[model samples]
Target: MPWQKTFTLGNKRKGCHLITNEVVNAIQDGLQNVPIGILHLFIQHTSASLTVNENCDPDVRSDMDMALDTIVPESLEWTHVDEGPDDSVSHTKASLIGSSISIPISNGRLNLGTWQGMPPPTVATGGARSRNIQASI
Candidate 1:
């Protein structure tokens, strides 16, 4: 049987955030007995996305945000500017990264790399805001 649930991540400024603990805590109950399975998470917004990365270093998160800004600079001319300058940039960044992630489960735990973690709500509205995430196990 598959287990599912929804959760919210509080708002933060424009940058990558380490959300592994938050996500795991929210879906901990569902992950308890899954000796072998997969955990899929989807963010319910276009402005923000999901990704796993090195959780040990704060620089990786900050650098990710910086790299994204470089990849999708706000100075460029964008057709979808209904919200503001960062609107289009935000969406583009989300698209470039993605809105979902899946990880393997082994012995009732996520089988991720030693240093890997489900961090970063990639981008956010106005470059930052709360994000709703749906988890399926």
Candidate 2:
């Protein structure tokens, strides 16, 4: 049987944030009964995206932000600036990074690598924001 759950994650700042714990805790109850399966997480926003990467170092996150900013400079010519300079760049970065992930579930726990984790790389937009995350088990 397949189980599906949806939940909203509170605002995350304008960078990458580790959300492995949040995802796990939210689906812990549902996972307890399933010994093996695939967990698919989807983010319902276009300005932000999700990716699995190093979790032990904070520098990696900051570095990634810097690199992305350099790659997708806000100064570029974009006609979609009705929102702001960050709007177009945000969409580009989100497209490059993607917005969903799939992980294996074993023994009621997410099977992630020791140094691997998922981070929601939020870009462009500012202020408090929430991500509608859907999990399917």
Where is the poorest 10-residue window by lDDT in model 1?
A: 119-128
Candidate 1 ranges with C-alpha deviation above 4 Å: none
lDDT (CA) for every model shown? 0.85, 0.84
- In candidate 2, list every pair of residues with a backbone clash: none
Those runs of model 2 whose alpha carbons end farther than 4 Å from true positions after fitting are none
lDDT of 2 at 107: 85
Q: Each candidate's TM vs. the true structure?
A: 0.93, 0.93
Residues 7-113, model 2: lDDT tens digits: 87877867888888888888887788778889999988888888999999999999988888899888898778666668888888999999899999998888999
Clashing pairs in 1: none
Q: After superposition, how far is residue 22 of candidate 2 from its true place, in Å?
A: 1.1
Residue-level error in angstroms, candidate 1, position 18: 0.5
> Candidate 2, residue 5: CA error in Å?
1.1
TM-score, structure 1 vs. true:
0.93
